[model samples]
Target: MDEVLFRGSRKLEIMQVQAQLVASKTKEVFATYSQATKALISQAIHSNQVEQLKQNIAQLIGYVLEVTRDFKYQVTNILEPRRLWIFFSTVLGGKWSRREVGIACISFVIGGAVGLGVGLIIRRRETIYRYMEAIQISHYLGPEGATVVEDAHAPYECGQHDVLVEVKASSVQIIDAQICCGYGRTFRRILRRIYKQSSSDLPVILGRDCTGVITDLGKSVKRLEIGDEVWVTVPFWSQGTLCQTVLVSEARVARKPKNVGFEGACSIPYAGSLALSALTEANIDFSNAKDKRFLIQDGCTPVGCVLIQLLNNWRARVTTTCYKRALPVAKALGATDIITIDDSHYVRDVHEKDPQEIREGDQKLLLKELEVRGETFDVIVLTRNDCVDLSGFCTKNGRILCTAPEELLSDSCGFFSRLLLTGYVKLKIVIQNTLGLPSDTFDEAHLCHATLDRLTEMVEDGVLQTVVEKVYHPKDIEVALNHVQSPHSIGSTVVTFR
Candidate 1:
């Protein structure tokens, strides 16, 4: 059992396996409660077998403890401010080999004596509640913009509307990577320190989505309770989910359905809520959805996929466009029809196929193609901001929505001047950027709990699913981000803290 467990762990580390692959290892299924009774009956006649099983489990736990302890702390003297400062410098300076060598020497001499005396004494009394006090982070040194501190300052406090959670899994998202690599880094640094209305302090961690068990509840949190397993999209800059524990708002929290594993739950909250908000704001008539024709320009995008499923559940006649590789997924997600795009010469193909039909200068050629085919959609969702003349296909009274910014669509000199012309051409076009004008931007989390409740029912009813393509450790966050950021990504990449 010891050898097998280590082999499995090593294989997982090498393969970067997803949650489903790990779940497949447990094949013994018991369909009824009587199975437990039968197992107990067998145990009555098999005391030796039960004892052997107990021994195996104990040995496995011991091995796991040693392995986890070794990796959990590189420098355990976290309380000593001076050593922490030097240790952090070495980490940021790329002197990890030297840091490990120093750790080995110190751990051998000072830790050796202490390990023999206090290790056994402490291990017997330790609990998961105590784990909350550690406030561990894999990276602590940074002039590079996002590395955080290691100490009890993390696993942050629960606020009036928050719930304290021991995060089982968190995920790397594109926005998170953008922030880490210094998208408005200096301005954010200044704002966080001096701004009166900012949410949290400087270096307030980074993970965006997570699944965990509620360890503590806030004063105003009525919807959740301690020990409830939930998923949350941690609101911006207050407290991140990268640590062992996180404090999330009740409004941003949702009960994770039994069908959703921790790894998969990490991916659902942020994208799901955003898509839900878009669809909700669209105000589609679900009772007559089949009569409502909708088109999603990029069906394989994260939010696009969720929208497809939601539209399907609403019985909408949904048409989607995607690369040839995504045909199967698009169909499985309930697209009524799919238009496959050839990446090699997408623009050229559209032009060559219809050079004389629509002679306007670089109009939304895609929409023109649909117009030539006499296909009009009531709702058209643009995943990318492009030079697309949506007026050609959108019904006059219907809606054309751009998920991206208007500035992205124009390449020529007259973009700003042409705004009125463009608006008049497609009178009902909606830019999501202005959805909640007069506010900073759309606050999707405001509708998070409501959206997730509906999504949870869909998941439990087997109508929707989470796509977790890869899983990683917190130490490999950059690698995980790269995977999800790639154009080939079909699903989300998650990071496990447990």
Candidate 2:
């Protein structure tokens, strides 16, 4: 009975071992199937994601191309000049009768002509209006001579060598005031007659120089074009620049200095030209100016200031005489020495002497003072006739020049008188030369386009500066002229158009 029980136990144990082996194989197969199924599902999902990403990239590229095409199309439409032609072709594609086509062409021609005529008329009227509203002097009435005319005749059309400038800003100079008071009337009248101009050319403009835009160009213009900014110096015999527009010879126009505005630039041309001419007359030039000594009388004047600055630029020593009030201006303009004029005692205390004698005495005293100091200059610039006797202050082989030589010739009335006076003046100059008093007269011909261009370079390089003390509008031109004529006026007085 024990053996049989043991056998049954063994059989039961073997069956249990077989059942356990089968269950292990089944679990292994199911796990392998699950892993393969998971890998396939992951690969399928990755492939679908890659395909979707490629489609999205394609769509993005298409969108960029569409934007580019749209931008190009818009630009082409805007830049195309044939758009009107294309529209006309599309609208008038159908055939029409010969009479209808002729009528259409006639209508177009008439419309264009009318439009052109209206535009020309408007332009002409505007130009006329601007010219009529200019600041002009009908007669020599001093500072109050300048008047704004609303019904004056327009200036003549541009000559072959002329350009029309729309004045932006102009300077009211002492010379302008002097001209208003008939300073150069006789000479200018002579010039007009020589040029065969009408004697009835009244209402003369008074500004000598201006900064402006070129509004019109003559057929012969070469160096300048319309809308170019220019600095212009009008001849004394021509119509001046205080007007809204001025007709200037191309020879008198130069590109304005880039460093300055219209107002600042306006202060330069006349003053710079005058100073340069005076220096040239004195035989002083850029090459020999270094370390040279100069003496400028009435240094508070515009020409005097320019002389000081220009000499300073050339590394020269400059001595100036001015009123006490103008001392600072001289110093700022780089004068090496300043002598203040005290005319109070001479004007007030010398009641017994003649006024002219008193003035001469005062000037002599100044010369004596300089002599006492043993001070001499290589060049002496005499701005006023009162100092014409200052030749003694010049060093050996030095020179004296008059900035306003016209004033010396002003006393003569007729052509013969002027001619004889000029001879006398020449004789006087020769006598002075014999006396070792070297002197020369300033010639306006030296103030030309070349001089202006050189000055523009100096100004742009900061070697020269504009000195404007006051600025006024066109309506206040009278005040500006008065200020320029005032004894206390410093630097330049500018009149702006806008």
Candidate 3:
């Protein structure tokens, strides 16, 4: 699939290059032809009888129109459907569609547009996707270099199925560091090559989450139109949303939830994708989990917060372990029980699974917090994959949903060895059931689209809330990244790109 998109992009680039060459040559030829034709026709009008001169000029007009029609059909065959659509729309306006019906009088529209030098400038093809103001990072930021330059990257082009958004605001995420510096080391070398330091390459765009107004649309795009306000989490490899204007694929975008403002919408993409994917893919029957114990670790983090809100909406018996500060919001989101992470000693009690689970409780130490009288959690959610081991978290055959890929690795490797040592415990990280591996398989669009749909419902119900800590300007991206990395981060940190 990657290979196919790469080839398609290459093909598009090649046709564009060829079009420029052809348009340039056509202008040169037309200049000479026009000069010579005008000179000869003028002499005939002055020297010959009016009837004869009119006859000669009429023949030249027929020849010119015939040639232009032939060339247009032949050359456009090489152009893709999207480009051809753009070309005709921009150069001919509504006349292209009217061409067949009004074939007899084609010269006024087609010829007039060409005579004004419209066809001679193919670079205008970029008007659909081009933007003047965007955030750009020319090179990877070192451990200390966390700078983002706003007011850069102008006149970008929208490709096929791409939508041009006049960004009202965009937000930052923890992954911005990985994007700015191309800093990541995974088991696979594939991603490292793209994200690694670059000596001579186009600057990488930053910011993935945004809410913006759609000012323009590519020829092939139908899902959205100009004047629509949408929220999107663009693909990391594509252009970043942290710019004055961004060209994004329609598939990765969705209608902004009306309940949230741009500031809140900007923080939903990655975190929401992870949380919702964790719940659905983990195969939890949210409706049926009202009586089951569901443990969510790190409720202080953004992903955990979203999970708690969603699980609570399902009336699931949710128990979260977070810092003392996060307990309020977690509880407000319908967490039936809360446990603090700062306690030295926790009271762990064993209990039998209850059909009617306990509903709500004050914050308690992990050891003192008895989720139930007997059985362990039916589902354990690790917001971050910091679990040293998974043995104590779940009952036998209990499902574990973790956001970390490393946990999946540890779960897979030394499986037999660990099973013998720790006894039998079946644990599965959250997205593994759906994604198989963190990124081993390809997802069609933003993995969060379904989540976004559900988010709309939750927001309308006045139950789901976007956790916001601080909103920063694009120039202060470094501050936002620092906040997200800091233990002091109150909730989600956002960078507003107004």
Candidate 4:
């Protein structure tokens, strides 16, 4: 009996060793399979084979779900707890002890955990790739002044009255250059503090207008829809349009005219808005402009050209002043009388005069020349700073409109001095209104959706035409900005995404 017991015990020990060997071999096989699978997945992802990776992952998830479903059905319907334990033991050759059973259970748990972790990692990677990355040209205060940043994580969530636009084209204006050089820092800092509650306002984008497709719309937006192409003029104190995308209030956007492309459409918004505001403030509309005489100073400018065309469409007689090189452009825009100026002086006929004399005589000479021809304008639009007081050239009840009011504020003056100057301007306007002076500053026009809508009609009707001097890619943004700062810029400098 002792020898039989010894033989049986030895047989049981050998069976245990064999089971251990089988488990080790199974674990090694699974480990090799997992490593190979991970290698293939990594290669697919790195190679940007997104579709193939997605298909592999999908198949893996489906197989896991089908296996889980079959296991659940068997456990719930065909096996009790005791039978399940027996089934696992039978599957392991029915020679497993309590220790071996525990080991098998642990292996199953670890395998499920590994599978779950892999699925989570793959799902996370897919989630990360789903979002569209944004890029922008941002200005900073330090040595890294302006930079083009990829994956800019600026907040683009739309508000109740806002729209998100995918910018196709934008134009560089004088304001963009000035802001890049730190213009309006103090005022914009105050505004930023109020809005964002942060002290620093350095990293701001610098663009005024753009043409783009609306990618998203706020709940309160009524007239616009996603995918509609539109033109926008961003508010001065807000984030600008020199980026892949921008968020603006619906009130500042209008449908782009069908007659123009993105580059042409972008060139129109800022200048067209200014021209319309100036004309509307001066009470000059299509209804009453027929046969009226108007004069535009520095008529080769973008805003000046827009003004000339709009007035011409109203059947008004347009007199314009420009440098000799810009005369053809001004005339082609429908200026009835083109007064050529020297490159440095406002009057070409006074070019031979002394610097001081030219400064003093150009205005007088031009006015005398106009008077000698019995020419007095019903409206005098000052688009640039001139030594000449064009107020004297308007008819008795004519209006004087200065479109560039910020130029007055740009002079070197203290806060109190500027306040007093502003008061003096108001007093002058009141006096002109009271005494019937020929020159009168128009009230500031509030830019809104209605104004842009009107401008769009004018554009489509062939009344207002876009003048794009040059179109630069975003890669050449610095060149575009520098070009706009040139005093000799004839029209608009546009930057296109494509």
Predicted structure 2: lDDT: 0.78
Question: Stretches of candidate 1 above 4 Å error?
Answer: 1-152, 181-204, 236-238, 343-374, 384-391, 404-447
496 Cα displacement, candidate 4 (Å) = 0.9
Candidate 4: segments with Cα more than 4 A from true spot: 1-147, 195-199, 342-374, 405-445
Q: Candidate 3, which ten residues in sequence have the lowest lDDT sum?
A: 354-363
- For all predictions, the C-alpha RMSD in Å is 31.5, 22.0, 27.3, 22.6
320-374: candidate 2 lDDT, tens digit per residue: 8876778888899999888877756654665677666766766776776687778
Report the C-alpha lDDT of model 4 over 1-498, residue by residue, as the tens digit.
Answer: 999999999999999999999999999999999999999988877785787788899999999999999999887865687777787778878788888778878999999999999998877543232222232334534212545656554445789988998889888777666666566554454445544534655567767888999999999999999999899886555567877887777888889998999998877888888898788778988899999999998787778889999888889999987767777788889998988755655344445665556545556656676677777889998876544677777899998887653542423466776557556655776687699874333222344667788879988988888898899876676677767654457888888866
Instruction: Assess candidate 3 and give its TM-score to the true structure.
Output: 0.58
Query: Against the true structure, what is each candidate's TM-score?
Result: 0.55, 0.63, 0.58, 0.60
**Regions of model 2 farther than 4 Å from truth:** 1-130, 193-197, 342-365, 408-443
Cα lDDT tens digits for candidate 1, 1-498: 999999999998867665666556543443355688899898876798788898999999999999888766754666576787677767779555656867877989997898878877776754333333222223323223444344535444577887888889887666565445433333333234332324333444667678889998888888888999888884443446777777656877889888878988766777676676666667764565665889887777666777788789888889987766778888888899887654444445655755333323333445555766788888888754543556667777678776532332222325453455345323322343346432223223443677678767877887777877688876666566666654446656787877
Give one digit per residue, the lDDT tens place, for model 3 in 337-410: 87765421212211433212211122333434443444478888876543434446587878887753322232
User: Which sequence of candidate numbers ranks them by TM-score, best first?
Assistant: 2, 4, 3, 1
Candidate 1: C-alpha RMSD after superposition:
31.5
What is the alpha-carbon lDDT for the whole of candidate 4? 0.75
Q: How many backbone clashes does candidate 2 have?
A: 0
lDDT value, candidate 3, whole model:
0.64
